[model samples]
Target: MYQAFYGLREMPFSLTPNTEFMVRLPGHQECLNLLLVALEQGEGFIKISGEVGTGKTLLCRALLNSLDAERFQLAYVPNPCLTPEGLRRAVARELRLVEADSLGEIALLEAINQKLIELAHAGRSCVLLIDEAQALPDDTLEALRLLTNLETERSKLLQVVLFGQPELDDVLGQERFRQLRQRITFSYRLKQLEGEQIERYLNHRLSVAGYNGPALFERAALRLLAQGTRGVPRLINIVAHKALMVGFGKGQRRIPRSFVQRALDDTEGVQGPANAQPRWPWGVAAGLVVALTLWQAPALLNWLQPWLPTVANAEQGGGDESGQ
Candidate 1:
């Protein structure tokens, strides 16, 4: 709603995993590098674990985008809540096996194996990326193991990368999954953005979204964002988006730290304490601003028409009025 007011070309804090908005923070960059190295080395299995909203899916998509189309035949399974039979068919279908739908389990496996071999012969590496893999059934995981059994003397025919929450580690630690666990040639744990890094992350995304004005967030606002959001990208996006709306509603160009505090207070499941005082009053103040704007909008617009572009844009019916 505040895109025009802020001069943003697009929403900067969207939860969607757009590679365009991706920031190469240290943890994510290191994880990307390790995945590249592991794949180049033809590692059969790789695992990446992170907390919820720590950008696991984004990283998975980023890795998918980074691989060369000519050298990589990619099979991405976003949901792994399939049975053993279901998984084999999924892999087969990803390999473009027309027989997958009609074939029985054994034939499906053979078709997948043959397809992997063909890709290898044509000098293409097959990569299967499984997202939300912590939900994978026990039997289906064994199916994945058996699929990895297909290999030439040089390297495994298909490389598998698992992106999942930290629960994935506990699942892998089970004695029943020991054999499969041993096959993971590479693994990395993704950490949340550090408090100091939140500033850079926010600015980086804003710049990407075509924000070229002076720094939009004040230091206090940045500090509040860093503390209240706990450095989780998802949480940061939510709070920052709301804070921007708060600023817009108050007709402020720079985000007030009070606004971020209000955003955090309004957010559920966020862990930060109410470190910033006077929260209720600021919320009331923002409400009063909105209320006052509606009450005296015409006179306010007439008075500020020459000084404020925001009011001028509103007069032109150009200001964003969409809901939060």
Candidate 2:
């Protein structure tokens, strides 16, 4: 709805991962470069960790899209909340091996190994990318560790990249998966975007979506957004989206502080940090709310009077006369 007003060909703030709109912030670029180099070296058990809404999934998708097709064979499993058997089955399906159900556990592993060897012989490297891997059960993670055992004499046959929230780090720290944790050849932590990066990121998305207008976000509003969202990409998208809506509603061309404030008020769970100060005092705010309620009650009741039955109206009328 705000696209036309803002001159955007598409929704710039969409939550879905779009490689076309990927922004190369310094941290993100460095992480991407590291992952690319690590994958090229045929490393097994790579991991990328980030805070929630820090764009881990987006980075995963971008990596998948970034690789050259003939050189890299990629299979992506977005949600990895599965049992050991289920996780293996997902990997089997991703590799397009038939008879996955008929094969027993050992046989399934052998089949996947064979497929990886065949792909390697065909001059293609296989990569399995798992997102939201923090939810993987301990047993399932162990199973993944075993899968990494499939290797040629020189290097691994299959490479795996886990993209997940910070909880994945905690999960990896457990004693049971020490072997798997040790196998992580390449790891990167995605930091939240900085103020300047946030501006560049938003503008990059807008430009990718074919927006060619004046600056949409004012300097003050952008700073406010950066502070409010702590520079998390997804949160920045949400607040910016709502702020654009508010700007459109107010018939404004550029986002202002008021528009951003209204956007913050409308979004749930976008509350400021615990240490954040309220724009007004608690006592004054409470008093104003109570005063407004009391002041508007009579008008609200009067507006609803016509919808009430005659008896209800009569009761209201009697109450009013008695009060008078």
Candidate 3:
């Protein structure tokens, strides 16, 4: 609603994992580089775990966009809350295997394997990118491990990349998943953006959305925003969007600290104690001043009593001279 008012061509803070607005902050860039390197090395299994709203989905999309279609055939399973059979079918659908729905489990596995072998022979690598992999049932996860077994004598026919929340790590840590966990040739844990990165992230997104005006967010406002959102990109975007709206409502072009606070207050799951450090040192200094004043009060009063008469006489002389 406030795009034109702010001189922005589009909404920059939308929650969608739009690769166009993808910011390669330190953590994300490292993860992306790791994925690319792992893929180049023909790693059989790769795992990336991040907290919710840490941009795992964005990273997944970015990875897909980065790979070459001619060299890499992508199978993306965005939702993995399915049974083993359903998971197999989803992979088949993504791979465009024929009659995947009509085949039984055994037949489906054979068909998927055949397709992978064909792709391998054609000098194309097939990568299965599974998002939200934390929701995959244990049996289904095991089934996926088995799927990676489809390989030729030289290299694996299929490579798997799992993108999920931290719960996925908990799931994989179990003894039952030991074999599968061992197969993870590359693993990366995505972290929230650091304090310095938040401003760059905001500006990058704004620029991508065609914003070219002066600084819309004040430095104090940006600092408060970083604290409020804990430097999570998604939360930052949410708070920033609402802050812009709040600024628009007030007909203000520049977003002040108060508007960002209002945005943080209005946002659910983000309305917590301020993440900024407490001013305990100031409190301690104040306490020391009070204690010193109280300790010296008696001596201070005694010292003032001797000077009181002289000060009164001088004041009287000055008054007498004025009277004359």
Error of 1 at 61 (Å): 0.8
Report the lDDT tens digits of candidate 1 across residue range 111-180: 8888999999999999999999999998899889988999999989999999999898998899998999
Instruction: Specify the poorest-scoring 10-residue window by lDDT in model 2.
Output: 280-289
**Candidates ranked by TM-score:** 1, 2, 3
Per-residue lDDT tens digits of candidate 2, residues 1-324? 667777888999998888787898899989999999999999998999999988888888889888998998888888888889888888889888879878999999888889889999998899999999898888888988888898889888889999998999999999988888889988999999896899999999989988997888889888878777788888888878777765665567788876676656555455475125434443213433454457588887787777778878789999999999
Q: Candidate 3 — which pairs collide?
A: none
Best by TM-score: 1
Residue pairs of candidate 1 with colliding backbone atoms:
none
Candidate 3 lDDT over 1-324, as tens digits, reads 678878888999999999999998888999999999999889999999999899999999999999999999999999898898998999999899879999998999999999998999899999999999999999999989989999999999889999999999999999999999899989999998887799899999999999998888999999899888888888999888878876766667898887787777666566357523333433213333454457688887797898999999999999999999
lDDT of 1 at 267: 74
Question: Whole-model lDDT, candidate 1?
Answer: 0.87
lDDT for position 126 in model 1: 98
Model 1 clash count equals 0
Better of 1 and 2 by lDDT: 1
